[model samples]
Target: MRAGIIGLALAGAAVPVTVAAPQATTVPVPPAKAPFTFQEVMVPMRDGAKLQTVILRPTGKTGPLPILLQRTPYGVPQSAPSQVPDSYKALMKDGYIFVYQSMRGRFKSDGSFTFSTAVHPDDPKAVDEATDAYDTIDWLVKNVADNNGKVGMWGVSYPGFAAAVALADPHPALKAVSPQAAWVDYWMNDDLHRYGAMRLSYATDWLYMLQHDKAQDSTFEYDQYDTYDWFLRQTPVAKIDQDYFKGSIPMFTAMLDHSNDDAFWKKQDWLGALKKTTVPTLNVAGFWDQEDPWGSWQIYYKQEQNDPDHLNQIVAGPWNHGGWHGRGDTMGRIPIGTDSGIQFQQQIEAPFFAYWLHGKGKRPDFEARMFESGSFVWKSYKHWPPRGAVEKSLYLHVDGTVSFDRPDAGEACRSYISDPDNPVPFRPRPISPTYPIPDWRLWEFGDQRFVGGRPDVLSYKSAPLEHDLTVTGELAATLMASTSGTDSDFVVKLIDVYPDNYEQLREKPELGDYGRSLNGYQLPVAMEVRRGRFLESAEVPHALTPNKVIAWNVPLRSHDHVFKKGHRIMVQVQSSWFPVIDRNPQKFVPNIYRARPEDFVTARQRVCAGSKITLPVMAE
Candidate 1:
């Protein structure tokens, strides 16, 4: 059950689940020296599905111990220390019973596992994750050997998503909850489509892994080294299943069947279901969390709506998906200026669980703890966006310069031809899968210089900043644009353009070779894409009138970063983010999944000069 089986095989590829196993070091707590024991038990649900559960307890307890639960689909952690690695010494040192369980239809558990839905409060007999959690807690508080009634939940990625939804309606004993880089909505945020653009590489590979075999752990095998080329050769989208999947992953079919964000996905919005709950929760995120960066923000915002007790708190760091658990001080080539992961784990995460479960510390101020990206500093806020934040719009000029001033009355639209045949690569030439386990995790940090100069991409940058310009909170682009094709895709990237002498002036050491020069590194802070057909309504599709200018609003996920003096704020526009996102085809099609090769055509797109991006800039 070692979570090291992270990328338990999906169809054929090894898309490892994001939970990282801790090392084998132990903290210096005397109570942790108590004898340890493990037990495998089946906890039954209201609907009679017995979940496979593992309970690790310190038999030599000095007193009553709290129950710490981790629920996952990537099999349970090993009964040995693999289940309780050295990283856990911090929490284990505090003295508590650790519980790991396999969700239904996973491993030896009794029921079917469907990744599509969360929970339906409307149904009296619904047996979703929330109910499963409720039932499990109820059973443990009564049947488990421990005496303390308090329980805490934590997980990363899918297990993280499990931890999140479980708290939608938590039991009384459920005290503190932490959902780290957990997935929320499939359509609007997280692993699949981003704002309706299909993440071809991720979804195709993940679905294949899930639907192919019921084994506990396995990895997908690809005949070629580069997936970008592999998926290209298997274009037309429909052939993915026809060629290898053979309709094996019904989830894949279900994804394409829903052309829009209809009820199928609406019911899966985990954040939308938090209106009534008031559990003291800690939502952890990574500014570079390519997988679920948008999820934690959306979850935190929705939780803030009714958090009168101020129990909901968020921690957005410079880490990647579960990066706080991976490396503490750095992400990609960017140093956090501190051992942030260690800081969060020991200072933030451990103490958080301790305060709620053991009643050892004072309640937090409920402020958002954020790692300022550009400046490489950690700043705590009484509230996110830090109060007096200003909304500034950087207008797109005909001259390709992004400025704070409006366009000067001229035909200032920037036009680019979108060719599906030669779509812009999301990464370098040989793009690998999203998970090479460790290395693939850092791809989101790849330098923007890869696609910066592409003909299909339109880039707009402002003059060098004379002072530190820090942006916090939400990011969005308002565009007046048109396309020659009836349907298209629009991608907007917000970047931080370092000074040409960036490397020379800086003294920090570089981390990895992402294949780019640091002299003038173009680092992307945030980005997103909107499928043209869904511009009107995510649940509906409409064709555009060729050459007619219309409004396209693209939401670039929120962030906290400072653009230092001499740096430039840039924006890049394109119609496709290949392989990562399927080709738009640039033509109208009710279901892009079934579109023929003929439906794929070249289209001329235009972004008028009046268009501008709104940045959430905080007043220093």
Candidate 2:
């Protein structure tokens, strides 16, 4: 599936107040008997910026309650809900005041909106997200009626980013923070770009709507429904500003001018600023999150670098961006076997906040908790990569098969001619806008059969496993490859190929269509694209020696999946992922965004016999 970068308005949950092992805990937050009242507040920041905030307080007056703050760039809900959303029902019984606020530049808030900004450690006067969160917490503890001074913050996607900002020099009252599917570094692996390939579809459209009218919502309108055609018509990134934006939007110009990971992008590397963690942090993630998926794990690892308190824990599940809000039970065309969404909300999230804010429970025992797909099992561990995990390489063979054994010396290399005019589609044709449609986000799970046999694509699938093959951590694709042109892009996808005669499970609750027969289903476990030029240096550019094989190391992020018996492992290599990523001209150009139409050229690509994908095999 295509990874998206949008941060949506989602629910919040914390670990339940229980000492029972995670899997053994499942009690939901019993319905609240105390009445609650919602109040609007324009909280003044340290810089005097008044943020529009809504405070939901329990009227039980059962002594003062802790405050749970969720700062978001998306508008705050205008009215309080009659019932807690099912996604957050588990947190309802804890009885803490819920504070929701819109960040600066969003509705009713007083500043300009920024997609992402670097943490300014050098400047004391810098007014970034960290400072905003600190100010919000300070104000809430000071003015709110809540007698308990403790506070906890959590949010999904963009708001998840807001939750992360609270960890840096957190306010004295802030105890726990969860940044789920948060956007961290834009250039590295978040939404905007992957490695150096521009996420053309997401970047342009997102910026256009966001920057068009800061005072109100302004989404870009397409002349036709098929966004694939809409983006394909806009060749070369330079034409976009002149034809549509006319250079009015600053973000658009910056995307083209700052094509490389230069200072502009470096300033957007928020994760690099995470030198330490001052508060207990719960970094949540989704294995299939289309947006901001990479940031959560990156932030978690960085915080762990100096975590003496052992306060950092991670929970990654098989869901898309913000999918844990409710849909973690099923994704794409498969049911994840358990109500993972409810489990995380009740067993993990509700308890995490309850203990920190109210001192009602103990910290979760596991350092890492994940929902292992395929097996439909939930796993908790003392350490990530589980303890005895070993690295293994699956070599590519000329016969279109992949295996752990080394390829024979006589094994020939495979070659494919890539044409810029007809680059392989990232998904099936007629792709639509990234928003306003369900299919837009589900594209990540589109049937691979559509592009598996294309001429420009090279595939290597492993034989059906006789036993379960479980991969628990990160993975990388190491391809000894070269292209006929000076520049190119390489997309490597790690796929789970199900066997024939597969059928849905009837043991658990029926997933309806999601539980449909899985015959021939090709699930994408992990995939990432690398811009060849960036291979030399993400900040510097260098063209490849024509037809000279060079190593391209592409990390497929982190995943936890079990390739069950009879299932096959597959790796699909192609140059273009369509509007998901901008096309690489294959010809060297000082600035790819400015390349002319004629600059596009055909290139012959080769994956040498030594090519292999390195996978983390967890010891049973």
Candidate 3:
């Protein structure tokens, strides 16, 4: 789940639109079939660089409407559509002047585009995303016909980053913004690296697609259908560039150049650019968002610190990276029971923009709104994580069974030999490429039974819950472990194991012989990887002394999920998670990127008795 510093090629449904409440009695709702006239224009930035923008407005309506703008690296639609897209239907029902603009250095826009989100508001000469957004909004209100003079910005993934940066230096006309699935910190937890362990397949494929061409989205043709085999063959990620790209991709070279969280990456931290909360920001996240899981949470937390106006809000659902904009009903084969995406659009997103931009319905009464998957209900909270949530530890037992109780004093550790030659696949075999294929989107919620009984993976599962157990907020794993090698990665997953009879409750849809059913499914709720070197600090990585036990804190990020009465909670720990997270050479090197094949070796890893997972359980 990552994106190039504010770089992603989003689908049309992924396009950002304003969120508003249902039509208020005072505000007349626009007809569902409002005809829109499309016009293309070059909107000039402060530095004289003109951005290519597409403006869509109701053809004959003279009623002034707030402008809903989406700034993106992805190109805009070439022509006006005969009808409003389904994605925008819920929000557009109230009437809006939709504007889509290509960011600088993309498509027909002028100037160079760097894959970074750093905005320099102090330097007059520095023109960044914030400046471009301010300039675009400045021009739209003046030039666009019948504009209410208020503009709301939104975008998914890359465009989400663009919208978030605008909060750093917002224009007066910019009334509201929703940065959905936005990327904030690159090195820590975003697209590129997870605690310094490079994401090989994603970085290789996404960067190649992004930089191969400037005017259009490019594709990287793979020789093998199964990318796992293709990536495994290219051992030591350095070969990816040495053989295929040959340094053609600039970001790819930059990533390799700065493997550590150096000044280069720190400068790209867009979260730092947000000096104050000047705009009413709505940060949206998908619980199953594979591309950007950590970003929205960080943005929401950062804004919350100094939100005096209390304009900052957040909404999370069971969608996968802009899945809310599409069919919100189901993820993979797991039915969410309702169209959560559209529900969020109509209930939260739409009303947010409506109350702020158009003065329509009432403002959202709660600070955070999350859809609980197990209970299948929308939960509103006065404070995120809720005020009464308690912290409890679920200890990992050496006996392969987990419980709230701790392990015996004699039970010190569980051992496994992690082999780089046969690294565990992040997903099932025939792993599809991140792009061009949609399988990557649902891999977060993919059944974990594929790796069942693997020797390399240590499974610790709790018995069935007596009642529904709801876990909200941040989750982390405290692993007291040691490695035979100098360095290693600890991949920890918090899974929900369904009861054997789980299939009976769900719809019995006919499968075409090959489809897998959802019986006794092992759904990973929270999972993350922590490199041993970065345990102390992300910027400075130190090699571990062989055979010495150390604590590895693996942050599983924030989640709002429920473990039903009949379901069991499980935790699986492993050393490697394959090409998704570039394989960590068990032996430490100053730069894993520069490590040779000899540096890769099978090493015995251990999880000691003291290890436990901290869950933010909702108190009764």
Residue 512 accuracy (lDDT) in model 2? 66
Q: How high a TM-score does candidate 3 get? A: 0.92
Query: What is the overall TM-score of model 2 with all chains considered together?
Result: 0.91
**Backbone clash pairs in model 2 (N, Cα, C under 3 Å; residues 3+ apart or in different chains), count:** 18
- lDDT (C-alpha) at residue 419 in model 3: 95
Compared with the true structure, what per-residue lDDT tens digits does model 3 show for residues 12-58? 23644587657757878776664788899999877888889999886
Best by TM-score: 3
Instruction: State the C-alpha lDDT per candidate.
Output: 0.81, 0.83, 0.86
lDDT of 3 at 513: 23
Worst 10 residues of 1 by lDDT: 505-514
**TM-scores for every candidate against the unseen true structure:** 0.90, 0.91, 0.92
Q: Per-residue lDDT of 1-620 in model 1, one digit per residue for the tens?
A: 65546546544585566988677898676544435687899999998889999988865577778898888877885554534565576776678888899987778888766785567877877778988889998999898875499988898888788888877778899998998888778998688888888889888877666556655543567778888788887767878878877777787878877868988888888666677547788999988777777777777888888888889899987778888886767668765568878777887888888888998877766579887887777778888766767999899877888988978777668899999988998877787765545555776776788897889999988899999998888788988899999999988888888888765532654665323446677888888888898888788888989999988998877688898999998888899998889898888988888888888999999999668889888877
